[model samples]
Target: MTSINVKQSGDQPNSTHCRWQWRDEELVLLAEKAIWRPVSQELFVADLHLGKAEVFQACGIPLPSDDDRATLLRLETLCERWRPKRVVILGDLIHGRLGLTDRLRADLRNLHRRLHAEVMLIGGNHDRGVQLGTLPQHPACRVGGLWLSHEPEQPIDGRDGLNLCGHIHPTTTLRQGPDRLRLPCFAFDNVEQRMLMPAFGELTGGHDCRHRYRKWLVAEGTIVPWFDSAHSSRASEVGR
Candidate 1:
């Protein structure tokens, strides 16, 4: 692992208020609006639409280039630090029909080789081409206690285990002074033992989660708890 210091920025909110609990050896922090597993050495991120930029460009969206490279480098930096055995992307690893371009394919192949750990894709709505086939298969893969998949399914009571999933890029709108920020969040359905991770890809968009579900909102590198019932009312009241 890279020996560089991983310090939290002083400008960022104090995460001491962020609730945390342990599962096995994992340091589960409700940070970045996701249940972070520090020991897996992997930062389980979901909805990384790697080729979304390319797809948008092809569709004449006129977005800036280098989004893919930027996202990959971010992941690379994390990998260098955590040195995880593997990065289990919950789902939606790719975007639309762009699949993995030659550049991205080569980059991913090189990354896989360099990381020395498997990069498992659970398969999602946007996955296409040989990308789905190329990802490593299961028995070797796991999240919490359940096998990972693209979409979230109702787990059998007791017998069903925790499933980490993504697809509905979840986000919540919060008021900060006069400005309203739509912060990406992690939604945890405790009754279901299932968690939805925020979209890790730069090109990905998020859906408003207010009044829909209880969530942990992550912004400025800090996690804030918000219940579904209070979302809209709180937002409106804070705005005034």
Candidate 2:
């Protein structure tokens, strides 16, 4: 089993972040559902799905207008605080072609201009080969020794790596017989050497994680190590 060291970050005294030693690298799991590489000074977030609320509104399904704004604000806050050398977004940067609005575009452009770091995006299925406004899109890229992409690596196709990916928008459920709740989580597949990021977007749906991937729940502005309900003993054993 791969060794992992987890600790609550004192620097983030509010408990908004945790420092994790995964493999040979140090990764910070932020309450924003993003990853921070202290050594590289790089910030990684996934599945922003910006403009999703706007797209829903277009379909006559009413959703609050602030989703886009709230998401952008989070991104801006992360960038400003971390001041990373670059910001890497895993995938699904925007909800759909329909999500694009003049205001959204302008806000994105303004955010781009204001950020001092380089921005990189990997287009996802929702992207449909369409770039995020004027942002550059690449099929995949390597950063900080990890295969960074929107989708998970397929070993059968001969593609594999210590990958950092985001498309699944992983979540775990808690049920108390009549009550049930779902929470977003980051999942790690040790054998595959993949770290699956949770959706960074507010208006997003999620898939239950595969049992093989141990999970870290992003809850209540804290990153919590969570063992599987069915196999709590095994999950805890592996996580430790």
Candidate 2 clashes between residue pairs 3 or more apart in a chain or in different chains: none
Candidate 1 regions with alpha-carbon error over 4 angstroms? 1-13, 16-19, 22-27, 30-40, 132-147, 156-158, 176-178, 227-240
Model 1 gets an lDDT of 0.63
| TM values, all candidates | 0.76, 0.83
TM-score (C-alpha) between model 1 and the true structure: 0.76
Q: On residues 1-240, what C-alpha lDDT tens digit does candidate 2 reach at each position?
A: 332333232443446777877667788988889999999899999999988988899999988988877888778888889899988889898888888888877776666666678888887888776655668677877664578889997433344446889999998665443454577988888887889999998799999774677778787787877553455444434444
Candidate 1, residue 124: Cα displacement in angstroms equals: 0.9
Estimate, for each residue in 1-240, the C-alpha lDDT of model 1 and write its tens digit: 222222232444447235444244343544433344654655566777877777878888877768888877777766676667877777666676664688777776676666566787666667634444356433213555554555777544444566667787888776545555677877766766666678888887887765546666676666665643654567656655
After TM-score superposition, what is the CA distance of residue 52 in candidate 2 from its true location, in Å? 1.2
The per-prediction tally of clashing pairs is 0, 0
User: How many Å off is the CA of 43 in candidate 2?
Assistant: 0.3
lDDT, candidates in the order shown: 0.63, 0.78
